[model samples]
Target chain A: MSITIYVPADAAALALGADAVAAAITREAARRGMDIRLVRNGSRGMFWLEPLVEVATARGRMAYGPVAAGDVCGLFDADFAGGGVHPLLLGFTEDLSWLRQQRRLACRRIGVIDPRSLADYKAHGGGEGLRRSRSLAPAEIVSAVTASGLRGRGGAAFPTGIKWKTVLDTAASQKYIVCNADEGDSGTFSDRLLMEGDPFQLLEGMAIAGLAVGATQGYIYVRSEYPHAIEALNRAIEGARDWLGNGPGKFTIEVRKGAGSYVCGEETAMLESIEGRRGIVRAKPPLPAISGLFGQPTVINNVITFASVPDIFAQGADIYSGMGCNRSRGTLPFQLAGNIRFGGLVEVPFGLKLRDLLYDFGGGSRSGRPLRAVQVGGPLGAYLPESQFNTVLDYEAFAAIGAGLGHGGIVAFDDTVDMAKQARYAMKFCAIESCGKCTPCRIGSTRGVEVIDRIGAGQAGQIALLRELCDTMTHGSLCAMGSMTPYPVLSALNHFPEDFA
Target chain B: MENLPAIERTIEAIVAAKQSLPGALLPILHEIQDGLGYIPSESVPRIAKALNLSRAEVHGVITYYQHFRQIPPGRHVLRVCCAEACQAVGGEALAEHARLRLQGSDLTLEPVYCLGLCACGPALQIDETTLHARVTPQKFDALVDALEVDP
Candidate 1:
């Protein structure tokens, strides 16, 4: 019998030389005249141990990781294919504390199956949600989602059911479902992971969404940075043609690539970009639920939000809702990045404390220094001090503490970091990414850089001016781009005052 | 300049193929750029006319996106992540190294916000195909050297 070996083709794993490891393994196996069926799977989200190779054994899938091309021959000599003892052997893939600990609702199938294989996707409980949705009425489907307590996982914690309900309620001939796959946040890769790992799941979620919202066509606005994800989704779309349509209530999906504009991640700006404009932000009044995507009632959601739908339907909504705490219900895939050790995806119920995520799962800073500050959410999020590390990861909890759980991206910084510079960078990023539709964002961001520079240069009283400017940007700006820029700036000022001084 | 007719034909074909699709501008722009490396200023008029959009509108879109380069890039494009996640892990230093290394070389170095390798950064991509994570100064130099040798 041919032995099965799995190597992650996930972008993160690929970046870490998984290709080299796979190639080396193939060559070594060929030289030894051993029959091996290699499958390029998705990442397990344990990035630090990437190029994580697994071999199917009589017992289970035995793991070997942080594997390099140089270690391939050594692994072979130790009979790794037969699950023999080797220094790199990590027993079973499921046994790792990283994979074992948390609730992996959205990312359950990632790294477990061959990403390109539709048959594999189907076999592992893939199309159940769509099937369930198809059997029920549209209102019933929306109600199920509402009862699931699934909010938009893409930063804005608006209830997903309410948004779907609005689209359902709105009487429009041409409603659209736009999956906001333009995940441009610096510290996040959950969207990319979900799209690349389980393309069928996203399609199933989108199809379910189409059934509920009465949308005929769906568009996934993906960022150009994720070429692998784009390729994966396109392939999945091609393979799932019969599954997606070819009957009554036909629904179609198209993948649109975004140009390198961060502001396009904004729902209205994304709509404008899709319409082939300059990605300028549109003022809210018509609210995207009422008028969106070429002035049609649209159901725009984040990739994670849609990906969460399949599980919500497969399992009961009560099961999902029962897991989380307070207003923030269901599991959120928190991406640990930056200077943290064991940085990767941690999908847990909403009540997990910030410090637990950082120290327990992340194993603290990679620099071996004291973790000074942690930036939860994206650049627009607050730079939380060690004092606030114990803060819960709940949306309302984060919001109450003048922070946000935007996209659940936690970027850790060591003692070596300069908070003042980080604050300046937040302003600078806003300046560069802002759509220039509003004054406070476009003009204020540039002014903010100057103010930060003055402060850095030991200019007195500039701190007061900076604070005043932050207040104006916070209040006067049109969207989160300008409005939330102060989160980091003020958080840095408040938390790490010595750095600013 | 010599292949202007060929370029025009390619642009026309791309526009014709995609113009029927809803909101065809970005896809058309992507095809043009992917085919010819950069969106030629001359093709803007043709795209504008095909999509029933103004030339100014087309130009504005082409310029607004950092991906749609008006001018031709070098032999290779190296994008170094400069976002906060990467910055926390010596990405700035890596960017600096890349800048100094590619100064007079036929490689274009641009600052990308993130490449979704935040977990294993500082990350960089060469020619938008090959991504490298946990890149140090030495690794950056070695990669550049390999690129130069291969080219």
Candidate 2:
């Protein structure tokens, strides 16, 4: 019998030399003349143990990881191909504590199967949602999603079904389904992971959206930085083209690459970019639902939002809605990144406390220092002090505390970090990436940077000036680029004022 | 002057290839850049003419996006992730180290917001292909050394 071994080809794993490790394994296997089939799978989100090699043992798939090219020969010598003993042996992959605890819905197929394999995706419960939706009326399909209590996983927390209903009601000749795969947020990789890992899930989800909204065309606007994801998405779309729909005006998905612009992550700006223009934020008298994507009624959602559709349709809406806490229903794929020892993707029910995510799952700072702050959401999110660590990871809960569960990306900072510098960076990032659409975002951010610098240099009254500037940017700005830039700026001031000194 | 016709041909081919698609300018510009290392000022009029838009409109789009470079880059592109996630894990310091190491070298150092390797950052992408995570200053130096020796 031929032995099977698994290694992740996820970008994060590849970054840590998974490709080199895979090459080493192949070389070693060839040298030993062992009959083995090596499979390059997606990440399980346990990034700390990436290049996580698994062997199909009699008991199950045994794991080994953080594996390097140097350790390949030793593993071979220990007969690791047959699940033999080795220092890196991690027993069955699914039995690992990090993965076993959480409720993974959108990320269900992420690390499990060959991302590019259509057959593999089908075997792992892929097409059930689209197939089920094929039988239902569009309104009934919409109702299923509405009943699921599914909100936009793209940090806005707007009801997903409501958005679809508006687009459905709006009569247009050409409607579009735009997947915001421009996962430009710093601490977030769920979109990237889903795109590169289980891309079929996302494609299926988008196809389902097309079915519900009566839209025939779909476009995924991915950032240029994610070349791997872009490639994976294009491949998935091509492979799943036949599986998408059979009739005339069937769902067709096109992958559009975003030139490096963080502001384009904004829905309106994304639409503008799709139109081959400067990614300036559009004024919202007409929401994207009413007039979006070539002046057609469009449904623009994040990658995770679309990916979650298949399961919501596969399993009943009630099953997903039953999982999370009040209001914020279903599991969230919280990206645990930065400074933390065990940082990776942790998808749990919405009510998981910040404390548990930070200490329990993240295992504190990677440098073994005390963690002082964590920036929830993207660069535009607030910096929460250690005192607020007990706050629930729910939309309303986070909102009540002036923090946001934006895209559920939690980037932890150790005590050594200077909050004042972080605040400056927030301003700087805003200044650089601001679409220059409105005065408050474009000019205010530049001024805010200067004010912070003045305060840092012990100039009196600059702090108050900075606050006033943040307020203007918060309210006066046309979009979130200017509006939410103040979240990090003020949060650092309110929570860690001493860093300013 | 020598590269004028070649640049025109590149822009023309790019626009011709992608102009059929809706909102074809960004993709055309991207393809032109990929074909020719940067989007030259001379190519703007060509692109505008091809797309039936004003030169200023094409110019505005080019200037708005940071990814569309007007000038050619160095031999090796060292893109460091300067986002909040990487910054939390000593990415700022690592960026500074990268800058100093490649100060006089024929290598370009640019700041990228994020590269989706947030969990194992400080992340760095070499030449738009090879992404390195958990990159300490030492690792960055070694990477630079290897690149320098090879080039």
Among these predictions, the greatest lDDT belongs to 1
Worst 10 residues of 1 chain B by lDDT: B142-151
lDDT of 2 by residue, A103-144 (tens): 888998887898889999999888898888998899998999
Kindly report which residue stretches of model 1 are placed more than 4 angstroms away from their true locations once superposed: none
Candidate 1 differs from the real structure by a C-alpha RMSD in angstroms, to one decimal, of: 0.9
Query: TM-score of the candidate numbered 1?
Result: 0.99
Q: Identify the candidate with maximal TM-score.
A: 1
The worst-scoring run of ten residues by lDDT in candidate 1 chain A lies at A242-251
Q: Kindly report the fnat of each predicted structure, to 2 decimals.
A: 0.94, 0.89
Model 2 chain A: lowest-lDDT 10 consecutive positions: A241-250
lDDT of 2: 0.91
lDDT of each: 0.92, 0.91
**Over 4 Å off in model 2, which ranges?**
B1-7
What TM-score does structure 2 among the candidates reach?
0.98
